[model samples]
Target: MSCCSPEGHCSSAETAAVPAPGTTTVYTVTGMTCGHCEKAVGTAVSALDGVTAVQVDVTAGLVTVVSTADPDDARVRDAVEDAGYELAGRATAAAH
Candidate 1:
């Protein structure tokens, strides 16, 4: 197990590296300006059934969700909405 970086953001570095044992889905959310926004999004998504872990990056507007099972897109949309951000939709690529 790892610890959160000094950035104080919700990062999956604490979970494991890439190719972790689960279905990782990355979504793009808009209008998040700070770490609190990231936490809000992470909390909302983490409440979903089968969800195992969540990491939100406000700078990139990406929320990466790791779950034991696949999550419905509508549910994801609602979760992001509940966090006061619009789900721009699933991200095609987190890396540029």
Candidate 2:
């Protein structure tokens, strides 16, 4: 089976650059139903000052971010919202 939606949009894990020595955090997001959603969210988050990579799993509603430092949650949340999605906060242990 292809890792794509019915609309033919394929999900992707986009890396902005080689990840610098940094922290990785996963955040739960909602309303991401296809690759476009993935790209939108990824682009927004990747624009953050310290972000080095962004992996969006639409099927899982999870966005894994690698950054030079512990990212500000408020900034991440705003980025997601700007991308027209909701940041459901950081992923909990159970969400993994």
Candidate 3:
């Protein structure tokens, strides 16, 4: 069986290394349906100031960011929007 959909969207599991000196924040995003989407969002978010790493889970609509400090929500939102996706805000227990 293939991990990708007929439309070319892959849901294979991915993992990111933990950053020892950074703060981790996970945000929910919408409209990421493929590897391209993941790369686009990851690139955008990774370019933000203080961002140390980014992990995008397309299947779960989650973007995990590691930064030197707590990142600004608005900046993250703008970056996601600029990448042609919608930021649904930070992931919370209710978002699960």
* Top lDDT model: 3
- lDDT string, candidate 1, 5-93, tens digits: 46665432222333477998888889876656766787898899988888777777777888888878899999889878899888896
Query: Compared to the true structure, candidate 2 yields what TM-score?
Result: 0.80
Superior by lDDT: candidate 1 or candidate 3? 3
54-75 per-residue lDDT for model 2 (tens digits):
8888888999899988999999
Q: Report residue 75 deviation for candidate 3 (angstroms).
A: 0.5
CA lDDT scores, all candidates in order: 0.75, 0.85, 0.86
- The clash count of every prediction, one per candidate, is 0, 0, 0
Ranking by lDDT: 3, 2, 1
Residue pairs in steric clash, candidate 1?
none
Question: TM-score for every candidate vs. truth?
Answer: 0.76, 0.80, 0.80
lDDT value, residue 39 of candidate 3: 78
Instruction: Give the Cα-based TM-score of candidate 1 against the true structure.
Output: 0.76
Worst 10 residues of 2 by lDDT: 11-20
Please identify model 2 stretches exceeding 4 Å from their true place: 1-20
RMSD of each: 6.5, 4.7, 4.3
Model 3 lDDT tens row, 1-96: 333567766653554654666898999999887777787899999999999999898889999999999999999999999999999989996654
Of the candidates shown, which would achieve the greatest TM-score relative to the real structure? 3
At residue 5, give the lDDT of candidate 3.
Answer: 62
